[model samples]
Target: MTLTRRDRLVVDARAIVALGGPLLGNNLSITGMAFADTVMAGQLGAVDLGGLAIGAASFNLFMFLGFGLLMATSPSVAHAFGANDARKVTAYARQSWWLVLGLAVLLFTGMRQADWFLPAIGISEDVLPVAVGYVHAISWGMPALLAYFSLRYTSEGLGRTKPIMFTGFLGLTVNVIGNWIFMYGKLGAPALGAVGCGVATAISLWLMFFALLLHVRTHRAYRPFDFFARIDPPNWPVLAELTRIGAPIAGSILAEGGLFVAAALMMGGMGAVTAAGHQIALNYAAFMFMVPLAISSATTIHVGHTLGRGDVAGARDVGWIGIGMCAIVMTISAIVILLCNDQIAALYTRDVPVRELAATLLLMAALFQFSDGVQVGAAGALRGFKDTTIPMALCVFSYWVVGFTFAYYFGVYRGEGPVLVWIGLNVGLTISAVLLVARYQLVTKTRLGAAVQRPI
Candidate 1:
């Protein structure tokens, strides 16, 4: 009962959910870690509390920036698998490791320099030691983090996601426990303050990486890749291909994320309470983005596999289906955020002023939810066709030129304040959706024409 190539591309809800499963697991566990870490940090006094925010903020910027490189692995691996070229898949993975390891070293080295940098961003001297310790502790975890990333995408590339779900739950549990042991003087632990958070997070990542390795080694399908054997030197061609494919997504995400980072820096100057309010709002926004992010991840897989099998029609269907799903999911989230906007904002602070500011910002954020859903889904569709360069350019344009510019204008000069920044995001995202969707259409059309001319 051999399946035809076109039949392989059929996407129903089951397929989409199956594709999104691993990403959802990763999102859920990681979000849990964020919440748990915040809860534990609250017990550590003001200085230590501030330190955790500084460290995580600094690390996330680099982590997400470098994510452009790390995430490039999964789709390439999927493309190779779709083409039924196992050797190419292994080769891509090996090359991806070289690139990821090199960047990991650079990021670790660079993180150490954040101490000199954070104070410049207006972070108080009181938080410096805890912040530096955070940098030191979390920096060393880069290798493990990369290892976990590689294993995760490797699983996804093979159309397997349940393991990621299971592993994420396990890792999150371990992480919270570690936080308890290290942050509060439990189990003969030192109560290392905010530094404890850095230590705990690093250990959690290490555990996830090794556990994934063990899973792949034992699993029947993945066993063939021989993941750890004879990791070869960096191959320039493959590395270049990865950078070409991934840098745009990173740039796009960075643009979106960078605006917030910039806002945080400005908010720091406004005062600790202001920064805290900004962080709380940003955190909620980050959590919300994960839904669209999940949809984007699934879109890439479905599109890539369809294209890999040379099923252009199937690829088209996958793209639209993903976009639709994202719209539906995020619209509902917007409603929830709007209804509970005040209550949600109040969770982070006792100060009434900060709560009011965050509440207003949350409303503005809600307005853009569907727009973000559109842009992310459109980008995911383009990624499916292995067409990235234009989308990359579009992201830079949207985030920096449109998002950042408008944010500064409305947020600062116009006295629109924080609510204005959220509006900027809506503008940028709307433009991004329009541009990327056009690009996706153009790319698939070109491919269809080429395939038709070849005459099966």
Candidate 2:
């Protein structure tokens, strides 16, 4: 029953699409919540939108660290599942809960104290109160958010992505409703404006977490994993192992996310109009990025599974296909952004200056879509191979050393504007794409060579 190369390619494509489809939906849903928050907050006023941007940037800094740590569960679980090591899979899943608890507490404390550092970062007086309120409200959800990540990553590793998709939509629905109710002070609740957006987001996180927990508890498909069959205490060695693998991942994610956070903070100092405009452009770019992000996630799972089955060639093929898919899709997205820049900008706000600035930035955003997609795809492939430390170093070099230096020169020192800042982002993403793709190639070639030389 040996299949032809064409048949195998078709099968690989099908597998990637099957895994990526729901992941795409899930990613989009999550980003949609952010999009909603931005749009709703924008309606309140430019100052409110600026505050949302700063608060969200700060929140995401801590959140990405927790997310990267929890993400260790995915590749570990995928490798175990592919190797048919059910005990190992359950062990990794259980240990992730411990990691989640630790991260939740740490992030919660940091988020609560976020306001103390706002003035140091140059957040304006008018925006500071709103940003503080937003962070404080959202801080309550750190536990739920980390818990959801642990469960979601475990499910993703098992190739059960539909639950994530379903829960994501459910979360989005709840977020919108909560925002309407709380932000506008519907039904006797006091109107809290931008702060209410954080409240809504926090509530949605808890809802999603509990929903996934209930599903894992009762679903027959998850019965074998025994996610709830026994209570396991914290295991330091296993926790350490997870952290060892995850720390570099966290660093890499922080490097990329930090670049954006820095840009947001820099824009904050520029003024409310500039900051609001930047948020609009960045939010749309993030929305479009979900497509490639989902492809990247699927690539990691596919590559890990293939490697676990001792198929190095198959893993390499999957990686390339995933990267190719991302490139092609992003090219199309870039075209769309170029074509509808004004129309898209108009969707976010009515302020003439903000709209004009955002529209201009969207043009620059189009230029970087391909680079963004390629780098994320390559990073995902590397993760599947359990090679992260080098990638982390590469990201830090690309983003901070190369990207920020240029951004500061053009945007801040020169006082050019948000457009020049986006140019820096494009440069960073392009450099990351080149280096990360090369790294993936080198890693795969070495692995393939080793696999061939081994005695069979």
Candidate 3:
């Protein structure tokens, strides 16, 4: 935490340079889609927006697993490449695909059964139809979405993120066009209204998937292994390794995703206005989270590579550099929120009450950025070490036991409103961040000491 001590973390500048740009770029584009999705949905009507929020919150719970499982792809690939094991990389990639796809089928089925899902989540009667429609329509995108995550993770594992950046841009464009065409009946399409948002999401997903596939086809780094080439037979031992590393990662995301899903369910019990306001805040947070989330990807790759090269100090450097970069990025973004909190809220709505509620909610979100940023960075550090299981247990206690408990008491029980709930949310994230940092510091020091004593 000291200035000079922090300065000592500069051992891996080239690795930082290699990672920082692509991860930040990818995060920004992904954030744009998140922003656009909420803005577009909110613009439709309060009812529609509330429904979209509910549906998305529910889906995110499962998506945490689907996405986390993709983590199985990257670190192993990085480790394999670092060890000069080309065969291992191919083997891990192929198995990671199968692992994530099985998860996707489960998710697709669950979404198809989302009608029962609504009532379980305590969705209000009037908003039920909109929520149901969004869930079902968006359900169709799950397979494409999983495919995209798998491919992207594969690329990142190989120390390539720029291809995904190109695809992300393509996704953003496709999303905007689809939203315009389907939402308002532009381009000779019928005005599908709120449901159109779901359609737009589906189309954007496919566009991103195919665009990346095309890139991989022609890019020299990826060209040697034609899809037609006989890939390594699926390796169960490798699958086991991936699962061991990723299950906890999945659990951690599930816990965090539960925050939104649980909030929506509780808000639905309250009213549409509350649900809509929650969505606005959540949409914004999701955008910001991409920074640390993307950094986690880089941390995993960089750390695995360093470890493979038997450079313990260098691996530690990658983790610290990632942490520093995330702090800077998130802190700068946080300033924008603190200063113009009200202005940003108003953009979400013309309704005075919704605007007021959103602005007040932003206050709860403001200072919490530091905690959220650091916690995500710590999580990234763990991923770099291929450590997920302990974090998963930590998340369960922090998020479900402490986080949801506080949210219920502060937001629901107190009826002291969203501000209290938001404050509680911050408390939960901060706690998680602190614990994760402490654990990582101890572990990193141990690794560094052992490396120093070894006969190099």
Candidate 4:
């Protein structure tokens, strides 16, 4: 049965959605934890929210870099699973634990040192104490959070995202209650403020890790690999392979994420009002970004599966399908932001000044939605092919060379403010989208030609 292009697109799109739907829920729920923190902290006052903005920016920069490093597990596991290599799958999964531990330890240590550097970075005296406290409190959960992602990404590669989704919702529930109890002084506890948000998040992370751990250990679907059979000593060679693939991904994430974190810090220098406003806008934009990010992740696994089975054409089809879906979805996202920017900002803060500034920044956020979607989508597809090195280089150039330069010039050098800073973000994302799409096209064409030339 020869399927036409439209038929093939439909089939592939269905596969991506099937995989991405649970992931979307999971991503949304995960992002909701941050949203909850932002909203809850806003109630305390602009100072607390602004402090949180700095703390979160610092923590997320490290956390998301770890996320990219562990992301290698998904495509690696997917490729093994696709090839019916159960041993390889288990091996990769087990080795990932070592990687997770190293990342957790390093990040934890780095987070605790925030007190030393944040002060030097121009954070206001009022905000500095809050930021440091938040980081110190949150650092306690680094191990558990990284471990949870190990299991979650492994499940994602195995095409078992529902468990991950369920865990995310559970984490969100626990976090919200904990925030109320700790942040509001409920049940006789001290109102810990921004620090309480960190404490709650840390507790939720550990619980989520345990919940996912239990499911993976007991589920029959995962029984074949016997993942919990025993903890093997660190396999140096396998660990090396994982690092080889993941390091570039970490670099890529850091380059892109660092730009935003830097922007947040720069905003902190301007004043609490500006910082709070920027955080509100950036947080919502990040929340929306998760939609396409989930889709991009699903695309990575799907494309990996196809390629692992040696179906180059299928891999190409699914990759393009995923990218197109991201673009369309983000277009709708942009429209929503344009129509209700103020309403959206109001959800974050009650302060009129903060709300007004945030709404203006969101308009800029809307301008970049298409570019953000396209870049991440293409990056996801590229990951499926274990093609991280070039993409990493490209991301660095796009984010740091292009994005950071422009942001610093317009926002700082010219003293134009955060709106122009956001415009810089748009330009960088747009360049990335164009470059990555071109890369995907070239790589696929080359791979297809190679497949054609090889005699069976």
Q: Compute each candidate's TM-score over C-alphas.
A: 0.91, 0.99, 0.94, 0.98
On residues 152-194, what C-alpha lDDT tens digit does candidate 2 reach at each position? 9899888889999999999999999989988899989989998
Encode model 3's per-residue lDDT on 72-106: one tens digit a residue. 78888888778877777777777777786688889
User: Per-candidate RMSD vs. true structure?
Assistant: 2.8, 0.9, 2.9, 1.0
Residue 295 miss distance in model 1 (angstroms): 1.9
Give per-residue CA lDDT, model 4, range 345-369, as digits (tens): 9999899999999999999999999
Candidate 4 global TM-score: 0.98
| Candidate 1 lDDT, 1-456, residue by residue in tens | 765645654434458778896788788788777667765675554456556666777778778767766677778888888888888788887787776777888888888888688877667666667767887888877788877777787777777878888878887898899889888879998989878878888898888888888988888887677766787887788888988877876776677677667666555545555555666677787787777787788888877777788888778778878888888888988998989999987776666676687788788788888888888888887777777778888877887788879977877677666667678877887788788778877887888788789966
Candidate 4 ranges with C-alpha deviation above 4 Å: none
Clashing pairs in 4: none
**What's the count of clashing pairs in each model shown?**
0, 0, 0, 0
Candidate 1 off by > 4 Å: 1-10, 42-51, 124-132, 413-416
Native-to-model Cα distance after best TM-score fit, residue 315 in candidate 3, in Å: 0.6
Pairs that collide in candidate 2 are none
TM-score of 3: 0.94
Clashes of 1: 0
